[model samples]
Target: MARFLTLLVLLLAIDRAFACKPEQHFNANFSDTADQLSGTEAGNLATWVKSLQNDYSNHDLFVISSYVKNASQPGDSAERRTKWLKDFLVAAGEDENSIVSAGTQVYKPENFFYTKITPSTLIIEFVPGCPNPCCLGANPVKEK
Candidate 1:
């Protein structure tokens, strides 16, 4: 029984690490400007995030922003883009803790299996995870 239980636990761990994939929500061409999000953009983003959270009440929320490398201005960088998004989300009444700022990375659509993608586009990916209190021994269960 001990050997069988050990094997089961190992298999389950492997499955969680490899078999389970994060559900990515793409906001293609979320922005044409690398500076900041417009009022409408911020509002829409907040509304969408909130709705998703409401629906997946048990899953944690994370935000990732990918921007066009060639579109950045002389003073612009990935960090700045991330800050812009974070500020916009905060201003829109989104809990800062709930938001994860994935620092600016090259907007590579090929990595996402897209052949044609716009320049200066920002892709926001939402990944689910266990919350703080439930981190230990808690399995992520997707809501219907």
Candidate 2:
């Protein structure tokens, strides 16, 4: 009986480590507000999160719902998340040409803010500037 129990525990550990398989999706969801996220530990990949927001904002088309497994760990900040997502989506079958990256400042004032992405956070406010849609650059930087 003791030997059998030990074998069972070993099997369980192995199963947890190798539980994930191809074609098996583990779904996750995030709230509409991503500036300050409040969700499960299974946070979403950056692209998926953005897709959800874009869809809500009527900016993106729901062409394909690609299945992508979670990374071993969630990214620490938006920049990290974006980079991780670009690589993750490509690995999960997204066309390289179809992918683009953009980020909005957390809270800063500037016409062309965030030239560097070393900082991990993503919720800075924009600096006061000329009030013009074309002049204000709210687009996130791409890494392709």
Candidate 3:
């Protein structure tokens, strides 16, 4: 019975480590040239950050930005937007080390028939992993 219980616990831990969490999609459009986040957007982000802290504290947060290529924009605009998002997440109390920006991806239409163009977007994903302090190279055993 003890052996069976130990196996069950091991299986549960393995399942959790491999579990896939849903990725969140949000519009990355800023209202002005300054790339400022509006009050509503800021409020929503803060709430999301709090949820991450409360529910997925053991997971690593990954942020990815996608944008449609435009001739008028600078080439590095997408990367800049991605960095901005990471900065915002860090500012909202998320551990900067736990947050990883996958950088920007250029959006490609599946075919010529897709006429609707979408604005830039941010994708947020959380994956199970070592939480901060432990993940930051600090010895967990010594911290206690």
Candidate 4:
């Protein structure tokens, strides 16, 4: 019994360490954008978004993922990432209608700079708190 308990504790700790801090990851920084969510910084914000779709999740609460950035990339696009996020959420057994995407391109005309990043955000509503949410209605994920 002691051995089992120790193993369980160790497993739980490992999971937490790897999983993203849901609360902070979905923060309404009102300043964060998706373009800036990547890389090692931002607490690995992009990965946190991915963690929400973990199969082991069982929280009866809504999740809102917001993407932000500092500037716009002429070739930058969130469509691909957005699709991945949707797929991730569905795979995690989350309802397909809870993902909320919001943000606008940064106006950086005539700026050919990789550093000219345009922020964006992706909000996944795990347990929606809003009435008449504009996103797709929550529904069980359909196995493909």
Candidate that would win on lDDT: 1
1-144: candidate 4 lDDT, tens digit per residue? 999999999998777556623232343222233433343434454455456444324444544433324344442345455555556556646566655455334434344254433234344445423221222247433221
lDDT of 2 at 82: 45
lDDT of 1 at 2: 100
- Candidate 1 per-residue C-alpha lDDT over 1-144 given as tens digits, one digit per residue, 9 for 90 to 100: 999999999998777667555555656344555466667766777777677566554445657565555445442545566666667656655567877866555555567575444545566666656542223465545434
lDDT of 2 by residue, 1-144 (tens): 999999999998677547622111212222322423344422554455444333332222112121112344233444444454446555644445544544423322342274532222332111212222222246522211
Query: In model 4, how large is the Cα lDDT of residue 34?
Result: 42
For model 3, residues 89-120, the per-residue Cα lDDT tens digits are 77876678877766555556563235443445
Q: What's model 3's overall lDDT?
A: 0.57
Best-to-worst TM-score order: 3, 1, 4, 2
Cα distance off (Å), candidate 1, residue 116: 6.1
Q: Which candidate number would show the highest TM-score if scored against the true structure?
A: 3
Model 3 spans with C-alpha error above 4 angstroms:
1-27, 31-34, 70-73, 109-117, 128-144
In order of lDDT, best first, we have 1, 3, 4, 2
Give TM-scores for every candidate, taking all chains together and pairing residue i with residue i. Answer: 0.55, 0.25, 0.56, 0.32
Candidate 2, which segments miss by more than 4 Å at Cα? Answer: 1-76, 107-144
Better candidate number, 2 or 4, judged by TM-score:
4
lDDT of each: 0.60, 0.36, 0.57, 0.44
